[model samples]
Target: MIQLVIVTVLLLVLFFGIGFILNMLMKTTWFPIYGYFAVVIVFVVYWGNAGSLTDNLTEYSYADYIPAIGGLIGAILSGSAIKALRTRGFKMF
Candidate 1:
């Protein structure tokens, strides 16, 4: 509902900010996309194995992971868009 929309927007904005920071740090447009994907995969695997390591048996369904994955996608897209704009000679102030 409205809450989901709000959260989605917030996640998008947050991830976009992260993407901007990554762009500044990495200085390579394509690297962040692959890096984000790798990071997400590592996180998912870590979370999936958390229960075994902690002996608490925590569980996460797809719903729980979607937002994080979506955020990563948003970040990658944001980085790519910025790269495209820069390549096209767009100026940012």
Candidate 2:
């Protein structure tokens, strides 16, 4: 649906911007990726129930996955961008 697309894009941009900023501030290329995974793990731990791992993992639909994929791509791109900038002699500070 249109809403799903919009939400996915929004999440992608949101994560990208946040990750980019974090990279600049932290002066690290891959920290955002690690930070993203840590945040996801924390979120899942907070929202998941006492059920089995398979049951909990299977509960999410494409609607839940698409945005996460978008966000992950965004995070990855952010790190790449920062690395590229640094390699090109563009200081982040």
Which candidate number would show the highest lDDT if scored against the true structure?
A: 2
> What residue runs in model 2 are displaced by over 4 Å at the alpha carbon?
none
Q: Give per-residue CA lDDT, model 1, range 1-93, as digits (tens).
A: 566666677777788877876776666566666767787556655566554633322365555556666677678777888788888997554
C-alpha TM-scores of all predictions: 0.61, 0.91
Which candidate number has the best TM-score?
2
Q: What is the lDDT of residue 56 in candidate 1?
A: 22
lDDT against the true structure, each candidate: 0.67, 0.86
lDDT (Cα, 0-100) at 67 in candidate 1: 69
Q: Compute the lDDT of residue 39 as modeled in candidate 1.
A: 71
lDDT tens per residue, model 2, 1-76: 9999998899888988999999999888888789888988777644688476666678788998899889999999
What is the C-alpha RMSD, rounded to one decimal, of candidate 2? 1.3
Candidate 1 has what TM-score?
A: 0.61
lDDT of 2 at 91: 94
